[model samples]
Target: MAKSTHDHGAAFRAGYVALIGRPNAGKSTLLNRLVGEKIAAVSNKPQTTRFKILGIVNRPEGQIVLVDTPGVHKPGYELNRRMMAAVHDALLGVDLVCLIRDASVSTGHGDRFTLDLVKQSDKPALLLLNKTDNLADKSKLLPLIEWYQQEHSWRAIVPISALKGDQIQELLDEIIEHIPVGEQLFSEDEFTDQPMRVLAAEIVREKILEVTGEEIPYVTAVVTEKWEEVREDFTRIYCAIFVERGSQKKIIIGHGAQRLKQIGIRARRDIEKMLGHRCHLELFVKVEEDWRDKERLLDQLGVGKEG
Candidate 1:
């Protein structure tokens, strides 16, 4: 047998932390707050997060890779199935699991189901009671925290309001304390690991969600066709919005392309803000009948089939 020596010279604390919760539990909001940036898309609708978004948070102690997962829900379609699988995949190799629950609402089956997943995992778990600011009596939170502590031996119990930024710093400190020492995974300045193209597509998709209502937003997909950086100042980007039918395309385009123009203007402003530079955005509407069901299209859209 050969002896191996472990190298601890470059020891630093860094690991993956997954945020799991029910629909509209403010997981995305919490992630953005922690990272101090809008990396994950946010919407009022349920299941707004369709993928496991990796947000990198750098601190003086170490780096924390936050995985903002899609809201766990019963799948109603193939897309939903893929989204749920993303959530499951994020659980693997996670150092800490922050099970966020809306403090204003009572615990339900959805919360229980996610808690069961955490209970089975060997990873350390933290119960995050979100939306504490909305609660009338802060004293009521103690019982809920006690209930969770009784149900499971959690590593820590934290009450916070992701929207109001209450107790967020304390939560970050707690997470950092539990992270084991290891080498730095990313540079101090790097905020996220996501590529620019993926982020650009997400920006447009988020705009779609913001502009439209009902099932149309869910059926929509944004694809960037070209990205041309002009000199060192600005960039010109072209994208196509895919819909399932001609009727849906018309809805997105609206009368005389008014809706599409609105989406473009808003998406451009957001992209510029995200990139920290001006952008010339061009948006077009296209009908890709049942693209969600098409394996090729789904794969092209980065919605992989493998779990």
Candidate 2:
């Protein structure tokens, strides 16, 4: 694989690009694709992302700081409210805003809601019609792109399939072209702004989302209790998954602790792959009744807290 080379003597271009869109619009997927790594938690469930995730894309042309934000939607609980607030906070000081939308679906209120934010922002905006592969015909993309172009004079309008890696390179080239010359904001080896502890928590949370059905995923929060780098290139990661009630805890633990074991094995594999080493992941399910509604709990969990 050809990696982006950096020229320390030459001027580097770096800026923040916020990815905003409705739930399940493939915003997280796009971020992972652009960074050439899985920096954000991806799930088929709506509102899978709940915070302003920073993914660093280092390319030969420039370094792009991609902000994968929570989906903009009506708030149903305290967590939802925090998610929306995070989205708004991410918009501030952004050099560019990439409004992603599902190209296969007809434009609806959710799409308009996202576009409204773009109109209000002074930063350069780009309307990305994502998931183009799902479209029955390629010609249909032209009209949708044109419609959005007429509605708003965006910096650029591009169609891409994040899942299929279609037109993604073109999208990155366009983004780099817009960023002004500057110094590299991050090291070439760095792929994300999030810390290792946070990443570990997210990996476990993603497993919870995968194995557990219904609202269990949303009600649960994962926190890293201890992370110790052991000898022999191995690490010990202890994490706790918080739930709102005993029943939820049972659901997470499952019969004979089979579900918990599943979450652990899957998370451990991903963590090892991410760290490029072996890992011993230990997960515990605890009932922190109504932790979602508790402000202090939310603060401790690193949600709704300013960075």
Counted clashes in each candidate structure: 1, 0
Which pairs, if any, clash in model 2? none
lDDT of 1 at 88: 85
Q: Candidate 2: global Cα-lDDT?
A: 0.86
On a 0 to 1 TM-score scale, where does candidate 1 land against the true structure? 0.92
> Could you report the Cα RMSD, in angstroms, for every candidate shown?
5.8, 3.7
Query: What TM-score, over all chains together, does every model reach?
Result: 0.92, 0.93
Model 1 per-residue lDDT at 144? 87
Task: Write out the backbone clash pairs for model 1.
Answer: 12-182
The digit string of per-residue lDDT tens for model 2 on 7-60 reads 445566899999999999999999999888878899988898989888998877
- The sequence of per-residue lDDT tens digits that candidate 1 reaches over residues 1-307 is 0112223343558988999999889999999999998888788778788888888998776789998888989987677788888888888868999899988988788878988888877689888999989988999888888778778988778889999998887788778766788877777788776777778888888888888878787788877889999867799998988899999988888888898889899888889998899989998888888887776788776763444
Query: In model 2, which range of ten residues has the least summed lDDT?
Result: 1-10
Q: After TM-score superposition, what is the CA distance of residue 147 in candidate 2 from its true location, in Å?
A: 3.0
- Mark the 10 consecutive residues where model 1 has the least summed lDDT: 1-10
lDDT (Cα atoms) of all candidates against the true structure: 0.83, 0.86
